[model samples]
Target: MPQTNGNAPGRCAPIPKTIPPMKDLTTENITENVIALNNLCSDPRTRYLFERLVHHLHDFARETQLTSEEWMSGINFLTAVGQISDDLRAEMILLSDTMGLSLLMDAIAHPRVPKATEGTVLGPFHTHDAPVTDNGYVLHDDPGAEQLFVLCNIKDTEEQPLENVQCDVWEGDSHGFYDVQKGADRQGPDGRAVLRSNSEGVFYFTAVVPVPYPIPDDGPVGGMLKLLNRHPNRPGHIHFMLETPGYDKLVTALYPRGDPYETSDPVFGVKESLIVDLSLVDEAVADKYGVKVGMKLLTYDFVLASDEQAAELRKDRRKEAAAKLDVDISTLHLD
Candidate 1:
């Protein structure tokens, strides 16, 4: 046997000439392998989604030459994001909004719905079964700066009135805090109310104009924003969830005039059609709606989609109610 430099007889042999060199395995080869694996998905939807995802993800990896450490860090960030969510919070949705994905999806999925009110993100704060107040009750039970008066109308695209349309509305206070967030009143849902549109397809309410405020920054999404040197603030807006038996339901927000972030909302939820100038009304005109003079009035009409979609939307409302009850019971020890 041939003697090796430091091995005994029969322990050494020439390396195989047919073996491929490890150095030939490059990033491009790895990316190609990932693409091939993605194509192996059999489910049509899964295959379609994963194929696109793999292509983009590989392209991103190549573009950035992302290291294993960087990839692991991203995985860790997503893990923490999921860890921070609870019954009352949706951290991932907030992350999506801040990243502009939510707005894009809303725009694509909602389309114009053809004369129906454009839908926007149902921000993470909606609570179910708000007190059913009369058409003119104040949403904000307490007084605050920037008086707000809202006149809402519900109708078909053809301008036919939708009687008994349910409108569920809520908003932050002048200080940008929802009633429940402030723990102001435990007996009822705070900063939230549901009212029905009258025979004229009209509903009115009084409240202080909500102040623009930042989304919660105590979570992973907040950390990312800080890293990106971006503010978490969303513009001043009122939340609305409306539906009628004969039209499509709408979930949207109304942007106030002169909010600093109106045009550049952090969540990208603003729509040009939704922005309305809240004009200062004469006291007499306000009093006609049971509001004081000098109150700021904002008016908008909601055009519902087709009747079939409206029924589905109403069913969603019921499902939302049940889900909320489960959340309350699990978190607050309440019925």
Candidate 2:
């Protein structure tokens, strides 16, 4: 029934109309809504990143028809990962490493600098303020490990030795446990040390022959791996961080020639050029290098890129990134 207010003759108050059901939710509408909000961002990079992230995430969910339980389980898993992360162990990095994202990022950031050693992941094990030592210093005296001498030669693209280069080297013990993973009662450091290259760009050190070992997987990441039916093992390798003025800093690893897990390294840290075949040297030859008899010796050379070359490489990378995003190169230009 209609009621009249009598303000005007034959005037009646109109009945309120029913609101139509919200426009049927659809995949296209949902994606558009998420992307539209991205325009609110002031920074172009942030805006682009968010827009892509939202689109992909929404698409994944829509394509998978993700269930509520599955979404909640993922949230719980991430929360657990965060809960267990701390100073010594970073669960997020572990997750990324095991998933090979770390290596992918490294490849993107460092696009195989010409004549320079290809880089690898700087695993979660590196610590700052490492004890600095002179050439030919041994970091570990583990009786169980086979003594192996490392002779490193650092040079530029022109094959000339570079001076004042700091060669930081570290590895795990014979049992494949780093110093940080061992009990407090463990004595001395297990495969961690630093030395600087001499005027001839040569440095020497005695370290254990690195053994293939499983990454620390007792935590949430390990649990996730178990669920994914994947093994958490890295190949026998030694980490090297070479740094010097007027050159690109190199973070690389030297893999033993015959490591069983070389092809399946959990972190994907292996590089073909970085693999070395250790040679067994006789006492006479060993004495010349100050290494014990019946031990092995590994000789390797590292090449570094100049600052100008690195700058040019970066420009190319930016262009590639822009192409990948299907955006104008100027959009990524820095203010």
- Which candidate tops lDDT? 2
Off by over 4 Å in 1: 1-43, 180-188, 282-288, 307-335
lDDT of 2 by residue, 60-175 (tens): 99889999999998899899989987766678988888888999988876677788888899998886646788988887868878878888889998999988798889988888
TM-score of each candidate structure, all chains considered together:
0.75, 0.86
Give one clash count per candidate, in the order shown. 2, 0
Candidate 1 has which clashing residue pairs, if any?
248-305, 283-293
Tens-place lDDT per residue, model 1, 1-335, is: 32223433586665423222233457678655565545555565566556557778888989998999999989999999899877566889889989889887776545565578888988878887588888987776565467688887888877888888889999887888765554324556667899999889899888778789988888899999999988888898899988766555678999877888887777889888888787877867676776777767888888888766544544554456548655332222111
Q: Estimate every model's Cα lDDT from 0 to 1.
A: 0.76, 0.81
